[model samples]
Target chain A: MDLLLEIAQQVINGLVIGGIYTLMALGMTMIFGILDQTNFAHGELYMLGAYAAFFFSMVLGIPYLVSVCLAILVGVLLGLMYEWLIFRPVRGKDPLNAVIASLGASIFIWNAALLVFGGAPREIPTPFLGEKVNLLGVSLNVQRLLALAVTIGIILALYWWIGKSRLGRAMRATAQNREVAALMGIKIGRVAELVFATGGALAALGGALVGPIFLLQPSMGLLAVGKAFIVVIVGGMGSVLGAIYTGFGLGVLESLTVGFLSSAYRDVISFAILILVLWVRPQGLFGRTGERGG
Target chain B: MKTLPYRNLWKWVGTGLLLLIVPVLVRDPYYLHLINMSGLSILLAASLNLITGFLGELNLGHAAFYGVGAYASALLTMRLHLPFLLTLPVASLLAAFSGALIAYPCLRLKGPYFAIATFGYGEIVRLILHNWDTLTNGPLGLRGIPGPAGFINSKVEYYYFILTIVALSLLAIWRLLHSQLGRTFWAVRQDSVVLAEMIGINSTRVKVLAFMVAAYFAGVAGSLYAHYLRFISPDTFSFLESSTALAMVIVGGLGTFWGPVLGAILFTWLPELLRSVSEYRMIFYGLLLWGSITFLPQGISGFLESRIRKNCTTGVARDAHS
Candidate 1:
C-alpha cells in the first residue's frame, strides 16, 4: 500500500516536469521539422523567457499571469530574430553550420546573461506557492498543478490547430519537402516565420511556467535544453505526438529514478537510455528512416 | 606526379625556427606559459579537426577523451609513480580505446543525431567522473599532479618539451591527411555513405579509424596539460570545453592544415588581451564565433587563401598585359 502511494506521488511529480520537457521539445521538433535546422540556441529562448517573466513580475510589479503572456511575446520577437539573423543565413547550406551558429548564439546569450544578471539564482514568487490539493492519498502543490494544467491546455490547442488548420497543413507540407511546398504556392518564408514564432512562444511558456517552481539560474536553460534534446530524439525529431508522449514518459522515468535510486544517477540513466535507443533504432522510435538528412 | 611546393616549404622552415626561438625571445614566464597553453590547444584543435573538419561528423564528446587522458596520466603518476614518458603513451592508448568503444556504437548515426549521441555520451562520461568518487575523487578533482621534471624542470624547458611533441604530432597529422587513408576520409565526407559503399569503401571503418586517431592525439594533449598544469578536474572537460575546441577549428578554417594552429594561438591570446574587462571576454568570444561563422563561413585561413589566389591570378594577368 505504501509503495503504491509512493509510486503515485512520484508519477504526479514526473508529469509536472514532463510537461515542461514536452513544451520545449514541441518547439525544437517543429523547428527541425519545418526549417530542417537545429537551434542550438533554443535554450537561450527559454532562459530569456524566465528572465523576462522575472523582470516583469518581480521588478516591474506586473502580475504573474500577465507576465507569462508578455514573456511569450518576448519569445516571439526573439524567435523571429533567430530566423533572420542565424537560421536564415545558413539555410540550404551544411546543416552543421546552422548548429554551430546557434551554438555561438547560445554561448553569447548565456555569457551576456551571466554578466548582466550575475551568477546568483533568482526566484519569482507567485500566489500559488504553498497551496496544495490532496488526491489519492497524495498532496500536490498548486504551482506545479497550475503548470501542468497550462501545459496540457497548450498542447491540446497546438494539436487541434496543427491537425485541423490550413496553416498547420502547410507546415506539414513544408516539412515533407521544402522545395515542393514552395513550388506548390506555400510561402516558405511565412511558414518559417510562423514555425519559429510558435516554437519560441512554446519554449518561453515553459520557462515562465517553471520559473515559480524552480529557481531561475543562467545555466538552467543548458540543462533544460539537454533534456529537451533527449526528448526530441527519443520522440523522433519532427514528430509532435512522439515528443508529447516521450516527454512525459521520460519525466516519469526520471522522477522514479530519483525517488527510488539517487539524484546523481538521473542524468547517467537518461543518457544511457538515449544511447541504447539510438543503438537499436538510429532514426528514433517514431522517426521515419531516411525522412530527413543525417 | 604531385610536385612539392618549395616556396611553402621554406616558409614552414622559417616559422619552425621562429617557434623554436620563442622561449628565448620572450623571457617572461607568463608569455611562455601562454605559448605552452597555445601548443596544447593547437594539438586539441588539430585532433578534433580530424573528426569534425575532415570526417564531417560532429563529435561533442571529444573532451571525454581529453578528460580521460588527463585523469589516466595524472593517476598513473600520482598513484602508480610511473614516469611521464610511459604514462603519456599508456594513458593516451586508454583514451583511444574509449574512443573506439563510443565510435562503434555511434558511427551509424549521422549529422545532428550523431552530435546529440556524442553530447549524451560526453555528459555520461563527465557524470561518471563526477560520481565515481573513489576513482576520480568526485567534483573536487585531483590536485598536486607531478610535472615532467628531472630532465625538463624549468618552464622554458617545458615549453620546448611541449613544442617538440606538438610539432611531431602536427607532422604526423599532416602526413596522415595526405595518405591513402586520409583520402578515404575525405571521400566519406564529400559523398554519401551509400555512394562510398558502392565503390567498396567501408565508410564505418574509415570513420572509426578517424575517431580513434583523433582521440589518441587529444589524449596526448591532455597528458601534456595534466603534467604542466599539475591539476586535474572534471570541470575542465565539460561540454563548454568541447565547444571551445570546435570554435577553434571553425574560426581557424575547417579541414585546413594550418588554420587550427593559427586559431589556437589567436584564441589563447585573445583572452589575455581582454583581461582588463575579463567579464566581457566570453561575450566577445561568442560574438566572434557567430560573426565569423555567419559572415566568414570558410574561416580566416580559407579567406586568406582565397585572397592569395586572387592576387596570384591578377599578377599573372598584369605581367601578360605588359
Candidate 2:
C-alpha cells in the first residue's frame, strides 16, 4: 500500500512538472512550425525568463504575477531579436546554416548569462514559499500547485486565442506555406515575428512558473530544453497538440522510471524514445506523413 | 617549362621540410601540445567534411564515434596489452563498424531529423559512458593510460606520430575524392532520390561507406587523444565538442579539400589565443560562429576558392534553385 501510494504521488508530481514541459514545448512547436528553424537557443530563452522573473520578484520586489508577465514580455522581445539577427538571413540559404547558427546563438547566450549571473543559482521568492499542502496522502507545494494551475489556464487561453484571433489565423496560413501566404497578402514576415514572440512568451512563462521550483541557473535551460526537444520530436515535428500530450507522457514516463527502475535510465529512456520514434516511426504518433521542413 | 616543374617540386619539398621541422622550431611543450591538438582537429574536421560537406549529412554526434574509438582503444590496450600502433587500426575499424550501423538508420531521415537522431545517439553514447562504471570507470574517468612505446614517448615524437596519421588520412581522403566513388558521392549529394539511383550509384551504400570512412579517422583522432591525454571521460565527448568540431568544418569551409585544415588551425588556435580574456572568449567564439555562418556561409576556403575559381566549381551547384 505504501509503495502504491509512492507511485501515485510520483504520478501527480510528474503531471505538475509535465505542465511546465508542455508550456515550453508549445513554444518550440510554434517556433519550429512557423520559422522552420529549430531555435536551439530556446533553452537560453527559458533561462533568461527565469532570470527575469527572479530579478523582478526578488531583486525589484515586484509581485509574482507581474514578474511572470515581465518574463514573458522579455522572452517575446528576445525572440523578435533572434528572428531579425539570426533566423532571417539564413532562412533559405542553407539547411544546416540556421541550425549551426542557433547552436552558436545558444552558446553565446548561455555564456553571456554565465558572465552576467556568475554561475551561482538563485532561488525565486514566490508567494507560497516552500509551504506544502497535503492532499489525501500526497503532499504538494503550494507554489507548484499554483504554477500548475497557471500552466493549464495559459494553455487554455492559448487554444482560444489561436482559434479566435486574427493574428492566429495569419500564423496558420504562414505555417502552411510562407510564399503563398505572402502572395495572398498575409504579411509572412510579420507572421514570423509574431510566432517568434509567441514562442518566446510560452517558453518564458514555463521558466517563470518553474523558477521557484528549480533554482535559476544559466544551465537550467540545457536540461529543460533537451527534454523538451525529445518531447517535440516524439510528438512529431509540427504537431502542437502532440507536443503537449507527449510532454506529459514523458514526465510520467520519467517519474515511473524513477519509481520502478533507476534514475540513470532517464536519459536512456528519452534517447530511446527519440531514436525509436525517429528511426522506426518518423511519422510520429500524431504527426501526419509527407511534411518535413528543411 | 622544365624548370617550372622543378620549382613546384622544390616548393613542395620546402613546405614538407618546414612541416617536419616545426617540432624542432617550437620546442616549448605547450606549443607542441597545441600543434599536436591541431593535427587531431584537422583529422576530426576532415572526417566530418566527408559526411557533412562531401556527403551532405549534418551529423551532430561525431564526438560519440570519437568516444567509441577512444574507449575501444583504451580498454583494448589495458586488457590485451597491445601496442598503440596496432590499436590505431583496430580502433578505426571498430568506429567504422559502429558508424555503418548508425548511418544505416540515420541516412533514412532527411536534414534536421537526421541531425536530431545523430545528436540523440551521441548523448546516449555519452550517457552510457558516464553511467556504465564497470567499463568506462563512470564519471571518475579512466586514468593511467600509457603513451606509445620506445622513442615516440617524447611529446615531439608523439606530435610527429599524429601528424603522420593525419597526413595518411588526408591522402586517403583526397584520393577517395578523386576516384569514381567520389563522383558517386557527388551524385548522391546532388539528388539522392532520382539521379543517384538512376546512375547506379547505390546511394545508401555510398553514404554508409562515407560515414564509415569519416568515423574511421574520427576513431584515429580519439585513440590519439586518449593516449595523449592519458585520461578518458564522457565529458570529453559532449555535444559541445561535436558542435565545435562541426564548427571547425564550417568555419574552414564545407565541401572544400583544404578547408578542414584551415578550419582545424583556426579552431585549435583561436581559443588558445583568446585564453587571456576568458570571460568574453566564448562570446567572441559564438559571434565568430554566428558571423561566419550568416555572412560567409561558404567559409574562408569557399570564399578563396570562389574568388579564384570564379563559378567553375564542380559537384554542388551554388544556389541550385535561384
- For candidate 2, the iRMS in Å is 1.2
* Model 1 agreement with the true structure over B159-214: per-residue lDDT tens digits: 88999999889878877877778778877874576788889999889988998899
Off by over 4 Å in 1: A291-294, B1-9, B314-322
Weakest 10 consecutive residues of candidate 2 chain B by summed lDDT: B313-322
Error of 2 at B266 (Å): 1.0
Q: Scored by Cα lDDT, where does model 1 land?
A: 0.88
**Candidate 1, fnat value?**
0.77
Tens-place lDDT digits, model 2, residues B1-322: 1011344688868887999999879989999999999999999999998999888888889998899899999888987899888897899899999899889887878877788888888989999999999988999888988778775778888878887888888878877876777767777884455777985778888999998999999999999999998999999999888988888888889888888799999989988888898788778767777888999988898887677667555634331111
Question: What is the C-alpha local distance difference test score of candidate 2?
Answer: 0.84
lDDT (Cα, tens digit) per residue for candidate 1, span A1-87: 999999999998899999999999999999998788988888988999999999999999999999999999999999999999989
In order, the Cα lDDT scores of the candidates are: 0.88, 0.84
Please state the CAPRI-style docking class of candidate 1: high
User: What is the DockQ for all candidates, taken in turn?
Assistant: 0.80, 0.73
* CAPRI quality level assigned to candidate 2 from its DockQ score: medium
TM-scores for all predictions? 0.96, 0.95
